[model samples]
Target chain A: MSASDPAGAAAGAPAVAIEQLRKSYGPITALDGASISVDTGEIFGLVGPNGAGKTTLIKAICGILKPDSGSVSVLGLDAARERHAVRRRLGYMPQTPALYEDLSPRENLVFFGRGFRTSGLSDRIRDVLEFVELWERRDDPLHNFSGGMKQRASLACALLRDPELLILDEPTAGVDPTLKQNFWRRFRELKERGRTIFVTTNMMDEALHCDRVAVIRAGSVLITETPEAIRARGRTRVTLGLRDGSLREQEVLAYEEEMPRLLAAYGLSDEVARISVRRPSLEDVVLGMIAGDAGAGEKPAHGGAHGGAHGGRTTGAHPGAGADAEDGGNV
Target chain B: MFSNINAIAVRINRQFLRDRRFLGLSLIVPVLLMLLLKYVLDSLPGLARLGVHISDYAILVAAYLVHFLAYVLSTIVLVRDRKDGTLGRMFVYGYRRREIVLGYVGGYSTIAAVQTALVLILTKYLFDINLAPDLIAVVLTMLALAVVSVGLGVFISNFARNEGQVFPFIPLVIVPTALLSGIAIPIDELPRVLQWCSYLIPLRYAVSVLDGVLNQHRSFFSELGPFLTLVAVGAGLLATASLTLRERE
Candidate 1:
């Protein structure tokens, strides 16, 4: 509720922490003993495939879903026991923009602000609308707005309370590239203001923007590490052009050692013409991990705070998109 | 809690006001239904020879109109709200189940209030009933019925997942009230088992009380017994509704 709110939370507590959280819908398990932690003032991303419990985890963090077992702590308060108190400290934007289609941006702001009992109503509404570049569209109804415009309006409502922690579920799913960039810019700006952000996105490039991302599959976290560290673990592709104009490609976890060993085996240095190397992208690495684990029931290799072993490092490329390509799930 | 309720109420009222067509229809439908009811009731054989004017039954029609319309309107709106994720958004933003049910009841009360006033005034003018003497009790009874209808709507909505799912419930609720609530058949004349089940219908109490003042010429205070029962049912429905309303998917 104030500039000092994030700091006012239980001192030294992480923004979010979940331990062995499990949830089920009838016979289908949504979250299977998933554990993760998010530090304050950092942008954390949760990456997963469809029906992989990305949303269920987000809801647990927001205190909207009670885990079948285990615990969730938000801002140092128990998520289930202190749901109301937890809600007061955070803002949640659902996968879809949940604004009333009949109400204008300004009216929506007023409604949410009143719900939060926010102070300085007029000033707060103006500031949020302007922050989201929605001031010009203040009086326009949401149903009349374009998709990106509706998103902006929804974001403005979420920020009305000046929440210490903001949770966005696929905030840029259908957003154009330019607006997607715009949204990340706003998220970073909020980050600069010392607010913690928890975003769930499957887009590889979007995952790159986070301080760290946790790849989840079948309700368990396959790995949690910095993008750079995870990227270092994937194999690099090497393409070779021979004197006869034939091109050969090879993938290696360590190109420095493997490339030379490969060339020596060919026994024809004079025949080598050209060479190019391409490292596996985050998407390729993620899909490889998920595929590797989906049918094998194999435990993901141990990973340290920096980077260690993760089983998702395998072969396969997503069709249509380049290895490193991003998808906004365009509308 | 009060402020949260007020915020939700204001937002809903704004939406109601903006859709002028829906608002106009809400007020007009009861009047049209009243005329239709009279047309059909007038056709019942031997009523005119028995010296009972068909218009004399307008009070019963008014009570049913309030119950049916209020229940249908509230149920549909709540189902739509849940489908749109606004209900989930509110829960994440700290709105409790009780506050949500109360807030909606508060919001829809705008339409209910105006509709109550319109039906009572039209019942007096169109039916030629001597309602002036017991105006306060009669109006209170009608308004309480509207409130109870709204509560029942909220309760029933929890059983439906989407707008399409509310269809089966429309007949499931409306038909029982129409047949067993004493307007179609006198309550005492029904079998004892059926008579006991009529007590479960809120409209039965409203009809009993409304009949007392409009036709039986009973003093207003004498009708308080059934009126209190109606209020008790409303309170019970609202509380059960709050308890049943899901805070999570």
Candidate 2:
């Protein structure tokens, strides 16, 4: 139940549970039985490359796109069957800052805030505006604002309802690193307040901000794991500085065990003056999983990646295996 | 639902107000068009001599102006909304298709009222017209046409993918309206087929109502048949718009 718990699996249904989703557009299938589970009060990331079904998955969860099969349950209610109920309980921020650019940030917030009967909406507007740090320029029209400012305003609108779950699609795609960091900061704040966030981001680095991330590619999820766990699966790179001034580099897996063996070879030898171990980044781990899944035909195309994968699974192959898919079949 | 609709309406109003150029132009264009109608009718003093009431033609022209402006503006604006994802955003924010449609109509209704009044006032002053005794009714009819035009605009916008796509529809609607709404020429003078087609045009009802009030000297209340037809067409178009509008992003 604490904020540190990524699963948030304490006495409540998972915040979002999507199962066996299959969506297609003509020759392209955006989601091929992609199943993902996000626990309550957690920040979940759906990471992938462009045209990786990330947007489709987000839309299905929001009940904006009816899945051809399977189910999307938000706060335990069927997303399609009870869309209005699910909609009332969740706030969605699309990839682009979908707002009236002519209106000021404050005006946008007020307009969106009116949809929900928030108690003391004016106070709530002030709070969200200040939270997004757009209160000072509240009346300045949005078109005049930079990309980052518009994003902050969009975030303010999405946060206005104070819904139990917030679904964001590429909330930080085009913003600068500082703004991206700022958005994540606000997301964490919302999570700390016991709100569940389901974020779809194509940027692998952004995945580091999520408590748990699901790596998807070509309408299929390849793996779901914490950033740390994914990174651990990546082989560490070891560099050795020898007395002869000749350097040696090696990719070592299970470095905890390999490091000792590697150092022992140089033990009692002045030839090995120094050593450096470069751990794999979370991005490498995730991209490896996505690429590995494409190579491993062993994984069924329709099979959902529901916590059932590792960073690398291509030791077994049918390289470039799954049916070719690109993201747009939005009905 | 009411709250959501109200919010959308208020937001639309705010956005419309900010675009002072469009707002000012939409209101002024109808009045300006009315003045042009006056000059054209005056130049046809021979028509008045031919036992034709030129004032009646002026009001029909005014009605056509109201419909054209409301239709064009609503279509272009809604197409932008759809293209820019505003409508889709509203859908994700829990607003229903019907609510969005009604909200948009409600939003434009206020502006249409102002436009309608402006055009009617100027039409009254610029030419010899008999809308004064029933000025309220005349305004209501014009406002009703504009609202229906808004609904029809929204409905047409659903078929368009972008603002450019919205223009092709203009000729589709305006041509039939001009030829079949009994405006440019009397429906009865046309072929029997085109006359039957006039009944299908919403503008025909508005034109019929105006003609009755101005030439036939029928009181606004007595022209209930065409007046109610106009209202019914508006309801149908609004409903059709709600149905056609995308429920998914």
For DockQ, the strongest prediction is: 1
Q: What TM-score would candidate 1 get against the native?
A: 0.87
Write one digit per residue (lDDT tens) for candidate 2, span A20-61. 899988788899989898989888999888899999998888
lDDT by residue for model 1 (B54-157), tens: 66578887889889999999999999989888888888876788888889999987788888888888777776776778889888898889889999999999
Model 2 DockQ (Cα-based): 0.66
Residue B168 deviation, candidate 2, in Å? Answer: 1.9
**Candidate 1 segments whose C-alpha is farther than 4 A from its true place:** A1-5, A8-11, A254-323, A326-331, B43-45, B50-52
Residue A100 CA displacement from its true place in model 2, Å: 1.8
Q: Give TM-scores for every candidate, taking all chains together and pairing residue i with residue i.
A: 0.87, 0.83
Best by TM-score: 1
Let me know the TM-score candidate 2 reaches against the reference structure.
0.83
